[model samples]
Target: MGLKKYTNINNIQGKKGSQFSSQLRGINLERVLIVAIDAAKFYQKALLCNYYGDVLERPFFFGVNQDGLNLLCSKIEEARMEIQAERIFIGVESTAHYYEDIVYELGKRGYGVTIINPATTYEERASALNWSKTDDLDLYAIAHALIQNKGMENKLPEGAYRKLMKLTRARRSEVQKRALVRIQIRTLMDHIWRDYQGFVEIENNKPKKKLIFSDFWGKSSLFFMEHFPHPSSLIDLGEERVWEISKENKLRIKETHIQTLLYVARKSIIKSTEVVSAELLLLRLAIKDLKRLDENVGLLEKEIEKELLQTDGRLLLTVPGIGVVTAAEFYSELGDISHFDNAGQLIKKAGTNPIIIQSGGTQGFYGRISKQGNKHLRFMVYTVGKSLAQHNKDLRPYYERLKERGKHARKAFIALGNKFIKIAFSMLKNRKPYESKQPDYRIFTEVKKKLLYTKMNTYLNIALAA
Candidate 1:
């Protein structure tokens, strides 16, 4: 069948045209063909359009495999030839991992690609046309958004940064799995030994005593659970046997722990029996899984550390309290800080920037953060910010001042997060290690004045050179 044509560019030239014109200044629209694909798991729905949001062809469907990618590329070539376009710009919605293969394929075929956030396409649909949803409609929205330049340039990580991301993400997944197993173990313990937590308590000078097994996932606790699944089993083994088991497992605990366990076992309301054998089995399985996950996490961390050392990530370690893990996370997420124009952009990308709410002539008040960017990066920034607020010399005073001014704990943390972004950005951009001492006010003033006079590109070049 012949390709369908849409020549009424003026109809879409009102708001979308102006937005595109402002954001996309240099690109000549007349010679460029825009291809937007609504990516899915099994298939992709695509629309080919011209520079001014004119559809040059009807929506096309293609598979996601090798044959499908080739068909899609051939269709794109056909569209380019029909439109007599000099360049092709392919736009695809970033729908999880569904778009990765297509994007990589398009890149390998030498097409300029933009990865549009699904949120952007949704907003575009809502604003441009109040229509029902379909694959074709979604494809239209993606194409429309691309013509308006409402997407990010698709640039995948490479080298050490790529490996770091893979390792860190795997580690995070394993940690989450481990946490789930711990919860399951705790739930099983509640049924089999409800007051097991009270067995060993250390008397501190503080009012609240500390339980040794409060960390339910500790090595000793897991060993105890695996060997003696219930209180009756523990009592049957006797205190000396328990101590012997602890010694065999190389657990550094006092003999008093055994006495505590025996006492709690005698007073325990729950008793072990053949009926509870199922619970014991579950407990043993959970412990085994937890141990495997722990080993996996440790191995992934070691690999992450090794990969991080190969990059300039070690420079981040110069900042007090920013250890290898936090630094590696930042490196993996940011993927070369030189790409960012300024620290504010980095902060916004991390989603720590405060959201301002206002309407009409009303004054705007700062609400919570947008939380619209990389949540993992935001979490890492928050944790690093908390550490800095407590320990970093310059940041601690700032944190205390905010607290003294009655700022909420979370708000203070957000503020510290913002500060951390700025400091880290400057340090990384300038290739300078962090200094604990605060700079002189005079030097700060001079630096601010110099920044004002310096062109942005020139400043970036200088920073990159450093």
Candidate 2:
């Protein structure tokens, strides 16, 4: 095995191990106290010990409240007085989100608290006590992990960073919910009109599948479905009436598309004609749910934009492929870029850095990514990578080169994600906007989207009357 180096705080195996070691450098072993806590939702168990594994206080339980916090503090003070400890190091297992309160409270009172990974504690226990387990044993494992510096100091986000984190996560949840609603609506559409979305048309003894609207959720298509869900209803309304409705709503639908839709309606089949009324009611309800989710998502994005603009993360928008939502989500996960010493640190944090393997007398080669850090952050980086690969003129060449070198598409995207981290790190650290060698057309695209959105809302209001 190679000799171990106790520097680089970015090491995935033991984050901030060096910092913890530096704090213990010339101190008397017995005088240094380590407090290990196993946190739960309602109560927590804490134990105090000296550097040499001498127990200073027996394990005790306290509720997760102000009174419980005071009791824990009193116990720590008593142990410190009895042991005459000059330095105190506290560690707590990251048990769900229950540990947040204790960590935040202890930090406020000026205690140096390290957030221990549960995996480290589990390994420490397995190595020491085999399969046996208990709260007391877990506490011992926590202390051992602390002694080895197997955790990182808690750095809680504040102000805009905190808001962005919460808002971005909320937005992600809402988006996922909206997607489920879309699926439900599609299921209902299939029941109501089996061939409304597309149908076979015969001409000169050749059959061709014709799509009335490329997007089933488009304004014109949705309006047609909402007002005239049944094929018979469309046939009765006739071509002239449909054209008048489109003109009145300013839908600007193509005449050919309208004719094709009517033809499909004449030939489309309904799964059950008797239950058509029931299906229509359910479809209207589903559409209402979709509209509500759409409004919620819109409101969330606006809030996210407000929070993002208040931080240095706003500079991320200068990149061609990045938008307000992507920039905000990426920045929310990466709080305070100064915490990272280099772009490599950011890559490691996202767990996008490749793993390496080497044997004796052989050159080391990279394997897959570690996949050990913030998974959400990793996903955001990967998304940004896909965007960059497809739309970024400056970065697309590098992505193509990776693919040409026999890298898989996903691997190429991951490599681009690491590059995005480097670019983002430098941009945030130096407070510079991205400067592309080629002209950035994304700005014009964004302006066009805004104009179209305004026009869409006006047409939607007119179509709602139909």
Candidate 3:
């Protein structure tokens, strides 16, 4: 229930062969410096040597750029130059927004760079937080996490991944800018004209300032303001003039709207103003930015699909529920499947493993993921699992089976996703495509019969006792 109860899977008691093997084989990790950066804010911490659930050296203050990543590469380069020892592993958490700078530089330098989840480092720091948070202690926690998870198989992202990461980040930026500008546009509209509030129609329900044109073709909005232009100027001009304009616009207008346009134009008049030009400019720029981002996303998706069809890529993609994108992401991140000796390492990376809460005589579990591994990989798997559950008939039986055994729907879904992750890992390691495993329907039927029989027996026994 508290910090003391949090446990790490440091040891695997099971043996694979004649002798026992460590779940993780430790490197001389004390020579390592693990770096973690929070991308949303300008925060980064670096710990010296072997801290990923291991203890060797302490953590320290690391620097992030004013933009959270501008200076990241320089810091990595400096660390590599200074720590001219056995090895240097820089582990960074994937804080949603892409850390292309960090991943590219560290991976380029041949350092054991890992893109992990920030929650993992947070859990690691739980023990060390006596008072408050500091960059120094954070670096230590990250370093400790690296040590604890030594022999941690990091999934090295590929070229397509880089492209995906870059495109996704750009898309996020454009989306943010649009959000701000949209607010300003909405505020302006509400102030000038509140009659048409919520009447604006959007094709896909997406918000856009350009849709405001539906309220005023040109003169209508201008006519509303006393100092602006007037709709009445075009009124007495006759039906032919309005028809010519509608024809030019290709507008499908009914007779009633045509009449209203004529009447309103006759009734509405005002002076000309300059606000329309600026509004038009902002709208044009916003539309252009959104379109450009969409284009890049399309290109990135195509490349990822191409990479997915690579020989090894084909093997991964053939797995149930692991489609082109998922397979590509998995392949890119996990360069080699043989690196992981077992499924737990893979599961840990999936971030689906439950964290335990135990104290005194009571032992229980909390519904938090051990977010200490490949967060991106974990999310990918979870997403794939959901997709599979909806579409993959093969995984449906397994999911139903698990849910029937009293797992929470969301939890069971993730558990199912984790289950698929293991299967996918196997298919990758064996260089074989996924083949659906048919359910033993008879076996399930027999089990259900036995359960019913047992219930009957219990009921009879209670009757006799009564």
Among the numbered candidates, top lDDT falls to: 2
Clashes of each: 0, 0, 20
How does residue 141 of candidate 3 score in lDDT? Answer: 57
Model 2 Cα lDDT, one tens digit per residue, 1-466: 9977566544444445556666777888899999999999776899999998888888999988889999999999998998888889899987877988888898888896887766568778887686435648989998988888766436666778778888888889888998998887778778888788687878999999878899888889878777777788888889999899899998889988889888888777645457777888888887888888888988888787666655677678678888778888898877788777788867876778898988998999999987645667889888999999998899999999999999998999999988989999998998877778885455334323433123434433432443
Measured over all alpha carbons after superposition, the RMSD of each candidate to the real structure, in angstroms, is 9.7, 6.8, 15.2
So what's the TM-score on candidate 1?
Answer: 0.81
Stretches of candidate 1 above 4 Å error? 1-30, 128-135, 199-215, 355-372, 390-393, 400-408, 438-466
Write model 3 residue lDDT over 14-38, tens digit each, in one string: 2221121232334443444455443
Give the alpha carbon lDDT tens digit for every residue of 1-466 in model 1.
9965433244354333444554445656766788989898976788888888777878878998788888888888888788778667689887877888888877887876788767678777776666544546787788887776666546666778778887888888899998899889888888888777654344574455435465666777777778776888878888888888889989877787777767878877875467677887888888889889989987887777666655667567667666667778877887777766678767766778788999999999988887645566788778887888876677888888989999897778778978988888887787676676755423223223323223445433543554
lDDT of 2 at 133: 50
Give the Å error, residue 251, model 3.
12
What residue pairs are clashing in model 2?
A: none
What are the lDDT figures for the candidates, one per model?
0.74, 0.80, 0.52
TM-score per prediction, in order, is: 0.81, 0.82, 0.53
lDDT of 2 at 234: 80
In model 3, state the lDDT of residue 134.
Answer: 61
lDDT of 2 at 86: 85
The candidate 2 region of ten consecutive residues with least summed lDDT is: 446-455
Relative to the true structure, candidate 3 reaches a TM of: 0.53
